[model samples]
Target: MSAATAAAPRPAPASGRQARRGGHPLAGTYPLLRFALRRDRVRLPVWIGALTLTTVGTLSSFTTQYPDAADRRAAAGTMDSPAGLAMTGPGHYLDDYGHGAMMGHQMLGFVLVMVGLMSVLTVTRHTRTEEETGRAELVRAAAVGRHAQLTAALCAAALANAALGLLLAVGLGASGAEGVTWGGSLLYGAAHTAVGLVFAAVAGITAQVSQFSRGASGMALAAIGAAYALRAAGDVGNATLSWLSPIGWAQRTYVYVDDRWWPLLPALALAAAATAAAYRLSTGRDVGAGLRATRPGRPAASRALTQPLGFAVRLHRGTATGFGAGLLLLGVMYGSILGDAAEMVEDIPELRDALREIGGASVTESFASTVMIVLAVVAAVYVVMAALRPQSEETSGRAEPLLATGLSRTRWAGTHLAVAMAGGTALLALSGLGFGAAGAAATGDGGLFLDLLLAPLAYAPALWVTVGVTAVLFGWLPRATAAAWALPVYAFVVGYLGTVLGFPDWTGDLSPFGYVPRLPAEEMRWTPVVALTALAAALVAFGLAGFRRRDLDTK
Candidate 1:
């Protein structure tokens, strides 16, 4: 035999007994559902707990801040301002002017975003992502039906959202906020869950259409962004635009006010339609193949992949661009509202303290500072994304080929780490610039533009700490890299919720953001910023050293 013919082909595993006798798909739904639940047990609970805590804390804080009808009205008036209306939804729910209603309005969008993010991540990871990685094929060969995997994933996500909704309702009822009816709280929770289900269905469909998990997630997030835009446009201008967005549908529920039950029907119907489409598409595609065909690539590596740094840049550029654009938009919106902050503060005394905490020498400064903090948070998100790239590349086996080249492990890893650290800084600066420009445009003060641009840079050191930790984890505990992403999330909880709820001082201090001096509010305190930067440097060094010695996972 010829040498090429002499090599034996690997045998395919024997297919298990077909469970669906009549060719009816989804025969193994129950078993797949159970399996998915088992897989997501730890993850789902953590998400639910975090979301519940955020909602409950926000409610408690808002209620305490605005205890009386007059205060509620003042708060409502501030929200009805052009800036707040553009950022949050329309002032429809603000009419009642009660603490409960105000808290619900304040928290509804945040909760829905969190739940929807979790839903998309969880569902996509299990369904199309598993198929892309060939995990689903092995399961399918074991008697799992074609639709069983997707069904199981959707079921798991839906169940998680439902459980979270119930928990949120119960937690809110127990929090002792006045006029907080169970029906209102339940409606609020249900609205968020419904949004999550719709996103899960969207993720399912995107998974079928996108060849890669990242692409699937990006597409789903784009859809989410579109929803937010439509909602914002509707809320800022015409009421009809609100009807077009899933977020608007959820908000239209108006929890703690009218508590409309009917809006949920559309969300549920959308989810159902999306799920049905996913199943139908699944039947038409081969296992591990997406509905969208993969385009052919160059036979050889691109010029961009000639070096470790180049490779890292190529891999990370897309993510950086996306984050940068988001930050820029946020900054612009925030800047547009700078002139209105003084007006808002004059109307609402409760906002005075909040504004003071955010950093405003003047009303405009205070508002700019508040917007900067939010911009900082957004930048921090970019840091987390940057830090997570090491883990992602490692897990995806993309790092293996790069490592096999002449590149040292540390050098290769360092390239990505550097991009993350630097990219985060760049994103923060860009956000500040966008914000400053908008503020300057609004107020006709070019000086405000510089101030806004500088605000994010002030928060850079603290943000880098988060990125460093993730790099360290990627180096020393590659298996636990997933846990590294949780650090920033924890920081967010402590920084926002802890401060608002007046939790123990130590709780806020634990966050890197807490340690970082608030810019524009206080003069530069280089000690803490320098300390955080030092910590980040140390983490990077340790991570690189550790990564150099660790075995690369090819699987």
Candidate 2:
């Protein structure tokens, strides 16, 4: 054919092994698994490394802090207190305080959380998210069977979790703690891996039930959170609650203590049942649809959507309510726990000394200061998410519709930014109020509420700086919004982990949170607050100017 004539006929979509009929539709599973593995290599390794490092770092820190029997006994005594036990699982492992037992008891719950998160994200991304975005459609058009996708995703998560577990085992063994046998380390690692597998199966089932990726992921996360809470309550107050949570099962295995190997089998059995149910559900549901159909919304917008700001308010109302409620609850819980710290100190004199050393003032002030720091960190996260709204709307194509209605770009973007800034401030205030109220109720002291309520405000300037950074990124480096989010992640690493791990002063100083004066512990310095506020304002202005000049990304 002539060149022009040849161009008239479109080429067929490319095809390979997927075009073939096979004994098992999953014959091409290895290739798909390989592709997914390559895609996730960098991100997956970072998560795994970060989690393993958390475990190893805790082990190293504990070794230095409690090198001998007397130190272990003191640490165990402090942990045995109800307040500490409530916060950090049961104290059975702490009861026999060898280095291995001490480290395992203190850090296993944290490790399980990390493993569960990794598994959920991995499974959801590959299964529900892919189907939502229509990638699975293209794959399914091939010789791929329904179960093939789920199988591949499960295999990937299993392999990744298995590798992480092995790495953790090696890292623990290399730490050179006495009584830390290879078998014990492997069992500990397997427990975490099993937890991950169970969650992966849960995510798989959730993906089949929920109509959207967000709903699926949310369901999975809710399950994880509930499991943790149940386990925490049970471990702290009653054994009955522990039986209800998978996390409790893993922790109660008591690595380096009794070293019972039977608990892992339940996790494995749960994973198997969950996986089979997910597969059955997958086969029953149509591609690109869910087991639970989406409910219809009203045909028109609500009366509340009349103005730009009102619309912004409506858009953010759900998140604002959820975040506000969660922060309030957290604050109250922290506040209520504060009263018991003094009693705990009375029981463990070394703990009192430790608190005094780490926290500059009295026990009450020290406990309040620690709680405030945690609240600040969490509040900063809310600020970052709020500030990223403009970027998300623009990239997701929602901003184009608003701009097409003759709204000025600056005004449109500014509306969202305004909500973020104001909403963040309100959230911090609410958090403080919540904690303060809870503290006061618990102790019948009105002054405690005032102190807790004021603490979050002290950290507001630093929180605003993070929001400003996100705004600047949205305006100037729209393509790199992920980098903007990374800024807070880096700050968290330095401010929280750096302090706990004894990182150098300069490293901690790099974080804005580190710069914010610790309130209630030390005298509040106005100088840093003012400087941070000015810096935040300048960043917002710079970002807005850049945003005004840049062309809208209509695509």
Best by lDDT: 1
- Index of the highest-TM-score prediction: 1
**Candidate 1 per-residue C-alpha lDDT over 1-555 given as tens digits, one digit per residue, 9 for 90 to 100:** 998879888887544544344244677789888888887777888899988877787777777777778777776787886678778766877888676677656677756777888999888889877876777888888655678788888989999999998998898878778778888878877887899999999999998888788788888888887888788888888889989889989888877888899999999999999989988777777887778889887799878787777878887888888888888988888888777777666755566766666564687886665556677777777777777777777776777876787778778778887888888899988998888888899888877667677877978887778877888788788767667656667766666555456567677576788787666666778898899999989888988888877787777
Candidate 2, poorest ten consecutive residues by summed lDDT: 14-23
In model 2, the Cα lDDT at residue 90 comes to 71
- TM of each candidate vs. truth: 0.92, 0.86
Q: Over the full model, what C-alpha lDDT does candidate 1 score relative to the true structure? A: 0.79
In candidate 2, list every pair of residues with a backbone clash.
331-435
lDDT of 2 at 474: 87
CA RMSD of each candidate after superposition: 4.5, 3.9
Off by over 4 Å in 2: 1-32, 313-322, 340-359, 389-396, 438-446, 547-555
